[model samples]
Target: MRLGPVLHREGAFGGAGKRLGLGWDVAGTVDATGVATAWGVGDEVVALDHGMVKPLGTHAEYVVVDAGAVAVAPRATAAAHAAHAATLPLNGLTAAQALDLLDLAPGASLLVTGAAGAVGGYAVQLAAHRGLAVTALARAGDAELVRSLGARHLVTDLAEVPGGAVSGGGVDAVLDAAVLGEPALAWVRDGGAYAGVVPQSGPDPVRGIRVAAVEVAADGARLAELVRLVDEGVLTLRVAETYALDDAAKAHARLAAGGVRGRLVLVPGAGS
Candidate 1:
């Protein structure tokens, strides 16, 4: 598919040495390649192939990708699907794989930091759907929203979780989306685990607690399932704002200003 709108994330890997046009999340239309049979002509798809410090052209008008990297979104209108496809790949997969690292049993308890953000928000919902009792730590304003997403315990701050000397003593696992670093380790039980998105900044293991740094990989099958959930209303994606490609810097600025609940999308040209 030719690239159209791409998603912008702050503090993403490869940001220090790079500028725009290096984003991994993208929503675009199928091109005229003979390989369009699976995706079809005029199909709206989300193609994820951008990598850290790698060749990334999704910010431009076109990006060459294999069929395995893209997923067609038929359930949503153009604008809505742009928002969904722009987000479904990276954050959704991160949340899914992060929870997989926890390997929690049914009825297990989980604490998700930054529960109002994109990855954390989806983690809250997906974990809850998997029968894990989720405790969401986010701003007070997002309490009701997180609760509706299936977070049982709502705390405005991570400090609300009492620190314990050992693992398996506090919550069962911690999905550290807020980048709490070592401080989040105290919230996990003696045998529990801590899953962080950033590997280099992940906490050191202690008290028999496992530390896992989640690495997101593109799985078209997984993306398709996530899209189905979105279409079925089981999963809801939020778009904080949409900007034309030329105004991508503005989207980055808005994301940097903080308190964004969803993603910032960059349309290739003039956007609605």
Candidate 2:
């Protein structure tokens, strides 16, 4: 979900008198609102900003979003997997922001903590696409999957490379998408950068490295680029399962259980 400082009252999960849809991702067609010049009526889109529309709705047939918070979704796979597109915005944008913060040179090395998770998965792919060598910290079983995503190296346990043993001194930067907190900062080289998804934990700088927490903002242009990656088969979205909108409680339970490969989606017209 969209998060600001705990002291900040406006957030996706806070400052709420009423809450509508709880998800941070959504994919659907624009209603009859032809006023949105970038998105016309009936245009399929994936809405971001943690799905916090003004009136607060996404699990229903209609959702209101800022004009800049949506990207045109590709039609090739939308028919079969519209729900999958719903998983892109929050995690995908977070990943994109993490990479942008790093800004490493081409052929540089990167370490992505929690590389098997949603945001980390995209980070790995995008890092690879940027010509950076990626070392993915994932479970043993995800080795092949991460390898396919362009990670040149894999470490099953973070402890194995406490101080960047995987790449001699350390990687050029780290994208800590799994919220590994300060502990993951050890993987970066001196003068390198670390971008964490959760800032509340407050990572200390190590060995002259720069550290920053990523806050995903709505950018329709960037989202459109990500969508194009999916359209071209450069990035892949995984869906753990789908539930009817009414079964959202059950979906939350499944998420809490953990070990989910991708995302859990709720469809409006589907049955429980």
Candidate 3:
């Protein structure tokens, strides 16, 4: 089985008082079935065990998830790998759901902060695929990367993004994947919308700008669509490193050090 750990800030997991297993994304072959369902033993699958404080998480050698939360894994291809597929469920779903909250139409202008990051990267590609004009805000070095991901405009510095530029006034919407908070909200025009990755933690609505945060949920059907995109080469998955289950702490430390450009995966029984 393959797993990916999400290292979130304090209270991101609801301030759980007890120790909890640490994983959200999992990809592996089904080992058994609880009932007569579409899935069977030896079937390749992926799932999002959606929760913040579960006693056990997908990091284990085995996991039990609602069948509805599981989907057939992406077919292996030159562009897709099991490790890369393991990074999809959580980040891909989060980006797609956040964009749904924006509800922007084709040709609408959108700015995505931290465009080089996982959720932001997917948001860039998906927004562009939907025909939105995407301007990515990322580090200067990532300009080409974000542009390659379908960002039409690139701004290395927040100061370079002028207010009231898109749609004759700020961009139509902002996807604050970088969690820039109030500063990012200021880029939205009046009556525009803002969607954030952190639930209920976005800046308050101002100037008639509608604001909401995405609380990611598991939707197997939706995940299956994303898998199709990956197979079609419309989406890209990046893996920064892999660690064995026993080296989870080291993975956490690597994450804390920052500069990670992709997801960190954990392979059970594999060497660090």
Candidate 4:
């Protein structure tokens, strides 16, 4: 909510994978791994920061992940779905950390800006599961979507949210997932906790309320939990469109257009 993307260059579990400006979330079968590990030659796995031998990504056919960072893929979710789930870890972890900072109990008040976004959607469901009064602030089209994720209150615009209606003089916690600067800051009620993914735009949390920029980490355990939700049919993966790996330029263009809703998956096996 307060910041924009935070870029980092950190190595994953294996000494094999190094940060080379690669994508984080990844899914694939281990082509091969080292000795004394549960993952074998053909075991399918998901890993956070699992880069293929150093600069490669999930967009490729093969990737190498450290044994510790991976877990078995859910049988019910498709490969594409599992691949998409790989992307959810960072955003999901942001939601988890933000909640920890808020320190609110069940039935507390929570608001997520950019509720229709990748991470916002996760935050909404997580807050709802915690039994909070979830409110989603997003474009008018997203109201129904957010509501389905357990947001009881949907505000198409900030001016529309009830003033001082949430606990502690406003929503108990604010997760800013949209435009980082003023839009997100203005939405958080005074005295309520605020968290942001973009450190560039929002006020850092100082007062009793905590404010933070979001940077998601890879956690196979957490990813598995999200996987469980999808398997139970409680969570759904929405892909607006997919592009072949070679058509990556067009995919970038499409994402730039902002016309695409849901995730844009890149199918490596698409027609070459």
Error of 1 at 167 (Å): 5.5
lDDT digits (tens) for residues 1-272 of candidate 2? 22221122235344466534355677987786645466688787887855333445455666777878888886564645788888888889989988888888999889898888788889999999999989999999999989988899899877766455433377788898766766677767778888888644448886788888876888888999999999898888888899999897787777666667777888988987
**Which model, 1 or 3, shows the larger TM-score?**
3
Per-residue accuracy of model 1 over 1-272 as CA lDDT, tens digit each: 00112222332454565654456777777766663446677788886774655546566677777678778763773744575568777788889989988899889889999898888889998999889989898888998989988899898766687444343468989999887878778878887888987645588898888899887777788888888888887777788777888886787677766778888877787664
lDDT (Cα, 0-100) at 35 in candidate 3: 72
Q: What lDDT tens digits, residue by residue, belong to model 3 across residues 1-272?
A: 00124434343546458667678899888898987688999888888999877778777888899999998888862223567778899999999999999999999999999899888899999999999999999988888899999999999866677564343377889998888888888888889999988877789888889999998999999999998988888898889998888898888788777667888888787876
Model 1 regions more than 4 Å off: 1-20, 34-37, 79-81, 162-168
Q: Give the alpha-carbon lDDT of every model.
A: 0.76, 0.77, 0.84, 0.64
Candidate 4, residue 172: lDDT: 67
The TM-scores of all predictions, comma-separated, are 0.88, 0.87, 0.93, 0.81
Clashes of each: 5, 0, 2, 10
Badly placed stretches (over 4 Å) of model 4 are 1-20, 50-54, 80-87, 164-168, 199-201
Query: What is the RMSD, in Å, between candidate 1 and the native fold over all Cα?
Result: 4.4
Model 3 scores a TM of 0.93
Model 4 clash count equals 10
lDDT of 3 at 52: 77
